[model samples]
Target chain A: MIALVQQDGPLRIEITEGVIEPLPFAIPTFQDESGTAGAIADEISRVIAADLSGTGLFREIPSTSFISSVTNFSAPVAYPDWKAVNAQALITGAVTESGGQITVKFRVYDVFSGAELGQGIQIVGTTAGIRRIAHKVADTVYSRITGETGYFDSRVVFVSETGPKNARSKRLAVMDYDGANVTYLTDSQSLVLAPRFSGSGDRLLYTSYETGQPQIYVMDVGTAERRALGTGGGNMAFSPRFTPDGQGLIFSLEQGGNSDIYRMDLQGGGLQQLTNSPAIETAPSFSPDGTQIVFESDRSGSQQLYIMGAGGGEPQRISFGPGRYGTPVWSPRGDLIAFTKQNEGRFHIGVMRTDGSEERLLTASFLDEGPTWAPNGRVIMFTRESQGSDGAAGLYSVDISGRNLRRVPTPDSASDPSWGPLQN
Target chain B: MKKITIAVMLVSALALTACSKNRFNGQDGTAGAGTIQPGSANDPSSPAYFNQTIGDRVLFAVDQSTLSAEAQSVLTQQATWLSNNPAYSAIVEGHADEQGTREYNVALGARRASAVQSFLIERGVAPNRLKTVSYGKERPLAVCSEESCYAQNRRAVTVLTSAAGS
Candidate 1:
């Protein structure tokens, strides 16, 4: 039955099965129903094309090569003209601005079948948040064709770094998934790292040196108001990830030079020690179901991944490879754990099954660590730093298939990205 | 009778807070902060003397927190100097080279700092005069990416301050 559908199908790329080659698509310049939004319409069209093309699953056919122009969004698509240009998908849109609000309506068409894949959508957002509007439109288009959730309508919290390596200053920052509208949450007076968002994307958990030691700090993403978490600030705590329930946090707490994974109640002020070995145990994350946790430990004499019951039990070692693994974040899909591996003086971003099989390294760099999952669980964003005195860190994303590696644009050097859940 | 019990409870809580303050020099205001003479590097009992004559920092091997003979020797002197100067407290800053990831390097630096804290305690320096903070590879003393710079960057520096409570 599947083969029958594909044989006479409207062009579709199986993102999970893997696209052998990028599917060719064309998106004409969006029409501006309101003459005042002509430039905005063109920009929205360009952004949508770029978003699809950036996935590496779609190759956008340039407007210069288009045989038929989409001067009217409601007009019937010319199938033969699109076929002549070898375009598999066609998208047309229109943008209108009234008062202080802007509206964008778009439709995705399977050029071969000459039919709209889904009902048209008109997204409404403020003029100040025009980029978000474009992302939403692209998300609709992407989901209509790929039959999967879109990651375009998302945000990432990262640490923006500046100054020389020896005296680098860092601030907590958040940006759009493509690195737009960067807003700094904290100034660079004190160093901050590893900002992980809550389940609802309304709050963040990160490590800050505000009290003269690395302590977990919780922040309201909207108001930027933050306070020290009750995880024993003087004892030194870092690497905190919110529990699946978002009512508590799982993090590493250091005492007398030894570190261990722990979970704490965000409201009741109860602390649970999850790991109690003399060896370093840090970077704990819970599976989506919240029954088990995946963490990295050096109890085996070198860093390796381990899985244990969330309530604390004898952990089973899951990473047996030759390299050291740290920062193991359980994928949202619950089947894989993404990690940072260091071996032979080089670093990598890799993923493996929960049972520790079918390991695949997605990126190798001089310094790369801290993997954060996109909402869809198909993409991973991590920090990549260069080598030498002038070394700088930047955020990069790679799909689960290990294709489409692209640097996330930022106004300054950024690292330790925590991709937030899809926005409402 | 209930009022009397409440008064006793408040008194005991005040006493406990006072006892906690004894752990650090001058923590209860400026008890010992004034007498620790602000002498230059020449004064035998001054923090400057301890920093210059006795090394202020000790280096470690890559990813290793175990102290070397050289690092141990320097730390031994530091322990004695800390014992001699009761009014000054030290913050041991543990650091790692840029060869490791951020979170792991932080753990490694903590181990180095803790090692120093243990050695100092063993050599008769009061635990109350010492605190530890790990910067991981965030703050490096040497800027280059070579081994020489990494060797220097992987270190534990004992910074002194008067009336320190942390």
Candidate 2:
């Protein structure tokens, strides 16, 4: 909870319970400044409401319960009417469309203090980008109220699956963080797995068996143009991730029946071998600072999480739990690493400190793997395959606290989710 | 299971003798009648015959890549088949029961395939004739969720292809 002092009045305080009790907010349908705005204004308002409500931090006051509605964009705030309904925050917006360009202007108000939290701003984009405008508005409102950067503006890249358990077809698909506006980046001609976004979100790194073997590929997200990373032939590659700077790739390559981690410079096209051992070493992820790499290995006899210097040196084992741990992803905040644990015939999604202490399992199921962090590091999303022969894979998201576990709706079976950073 | 294996062996032996009888089958007309007996494990045209009759796969225990006595028996047979079939190379595709993380399962699958490869090499199969690929849990042999199906799914299958160098 955060306490905000009224900027318009003298020392009047208001408490915003962002987590305990969701702050009550109302978003009246945006006014269409031009008749050509069509239904985009209402659609944008709905997306904004959905984004805020999905966070579990805001309770939307239905339009029917509203005591008052603002029909004009420049109208004054009726604080008493909103306060009567126990609404703590109010959002107002207007949309205009001209020459195929759409502009959305919005303002957030503290209903109790009757103060505009900040100056209203207008964002313009193509009409096709109206959803992004809505997300921008929600991001602004969320940031202003909670004092935290909003993740609504981010995107997710995941594996879209179809067909049966024996012969499933998978392709790379990208969508908004809320699972809207999905666009397929690859066809199902070849099997694809674990699509990860570069820090800039302009490119994707994933494993593909298009050439009759598993190999890593980097694709431009916009153009869908892709090229495979050179593995010098007679070697198999998978489990690829980008460095924080997005200038390098760290991945696992198997040659002569031995799997080890390696790093490749995206520009220089040179490979740096990271780990050398007879045991299997895969699933390498870099620390937030790129100073160290955490990966899974069977070098210690069972699959365990380990950390080593980025330049590849003596590795220290981190996880000492009973189960085998793999798919370790360092959180953006650098304090925690999320992984999938298999124990006693059950799979779990869990988090632990960098030192391997305070290990907490957030989810347990028949299968849950491939954990990816939200841009804000407050949430984690992973693939959860249902139990049974008819069971299908689905994408699920959970807050770091393990509350608010929700399935992200997808058109078909989804897996290998990798949430991209917030778009610029 | 023992009866089924014996029945399959008897049927294959009968088919091998029938196919050995000289007849010009258009499928392999380029070769002489007895050059390619495209039946049973001895037939070059029927990889399925080798897969089913000669046993192209070895199953493993859950989460254990170390070959059991039964898996070793199967691999011994596979090694013998590979030794006799010198024109073919085998790609060992390792698969797991759908029970673990994708990345770890891939590594586990690799270990399983490598185990099979190493065992075959020790059994006199040429190392250069063997390659390994792990499909992880992505491809399952059986769709059922029970142990009966998972046992079949946790396997390393030796798929034979014509040796590129040969």
Candidate 3:
């Protein structure tokens, strides 16, 4: 927890500098110009503030600390009053409703410079999606101030877990990036794991233990409709991911006793085996550009990561550290691959360059696995299960710079988060 | 007392004769020989017998699929039991301890299950009567984080089904 009005310096924060002091910012409740939208306008303003403050990059200045309040939508700038309260950034907005739709307009201001950082913009949406409208507002402000895309408007598909560790039941679920609007996709009668999002963010691919077999299934997110992906026919298959184009899938298929990587054309129904190995090979992920794939294999007698072309061929080993690596997820930016590493009984969430250099472990825990990259490629979310008879699993996220580690709030014990792209 | 004991032995012999005829189609084989109740742990042909006497599961070491001598011993008995019960098909469920990543544990469990499958095939069990699935670290028999529990969690269980066998 950080104080609302704190300061480090006026210098521009370089993201690569690692953990820095939180910048102080203030967002006054959007003025309800129509008076009819007062409640919703305040709600929208609160959501935007929560979205920005949750990043740990900015701290909120409580309304009680404000020296002056602007009750007008087009009020002249009172930058001196904002700077007097130690505010480095300020956001002011107004909301109005006509019939069923509401319009929200906001401006981002650099209090130190006494100028609006970006031109004021207005967003129009229905009252039913007020929170989404707020998230979009925060995203615009974040992009203008940080010079990076925002992840606030995205949704995460994950495995919602229930019951005890030994007798647990898992259901496929989707929720807002901030853990709101939870809607389950499957019942708890069967076990599910590792739900991945399509590039468009409207479809999902996951593994389910239906038919007394572990098989992959692709689902239409809006309809909750699904069908088994018949890549392996009568064999066991799991750990599926969609290609960048969403026209193909890469997954693991087990035959006889060996598990290997496989690809399937979603539209043409053509299947291709990507790896042929007697040793264990599974958990394959495609590069952002879809030309390369990173996967884990024990072909060298232990679990290590290897890179191969999207089309099958010989794989070049990439992971050379002392620890074992698995669940390698390519960053949305296509530059880094995040993975789960285990060494000497401890687990870590780590990231490495595509060529396996600059290997940095972002988090260490009793159990941390299944890293999912945020749309901006600046943060990674994963599952962290505690160690004990009563230990439980939960979702957590960390900045790519390895700071601001926080548990993502969820309705129940959850794991295996796959973040979708920013909503349109 | 001696006369009654002789009479009882004759009746038991009659019951064993009925069992040798495969009267129950040899599917579950829960019916016992002679005085033992059907499906009881003491029943020689019952799945309970296979579970308790022939061993329904084989344990694996951390991150290893190489069968230990003890595991092979249990699997050998399982093979003989399956061979005798021709009406049963087996689904070998391979599992791993909660110490590894989800998908890697899955691949490791597959290796363990395949090891057992190979051993069973070597022992003359029909390959068609066998199928394998790796649960990875999704399911666990023991919930603790210690080696004692992990040893039990890392196992491959041969679950018998009543489906017709070729």
Give the TM-score of chain A, superposed on the true chain A, for all candidates in the order listed: 0.97, 0.94, 0.96
- Candidates ranked by DockQ: 1, 3, 2
Best by DockQ: 1
Docking class of 1: acceptable
Clashing pairs in 2: none
Rank the models by TM-score, top first: 3, 1, 2
Sort order, lDDT high to low: 3, 1, 2
How does each model score on TM-score? 0.91, 0.89, 0.92
Pairs clashing in candidate 3?
B30-B39
Tens-digit lDDT string for candidate 3 (A137-167): 9999878767789999999999999899889
Residues B24-129 of candidate 2: C-alpha lDDT, one tens digit per residue: 2223224354565555444644554457655778898877889999889888877887787787787888989887778767877888998999999999999888
Overall lDDT per candidate, in order of appearance: 0.84, 0.83, 0.85
Model 3 iRMS (Å) reads 17.3
Candidates' RMSD to native: 8.0, 8.9, 10.3
> In terms of docking quality, how is candidate 3 classified?
incorrect
DockQ of each: 0.24, 0.20, 0.22
| Model 3: residues with Cα > 4 Å off, grouped in runs | A1-13, B1-35
Angstrom error at residue A6, model 1: 5.3
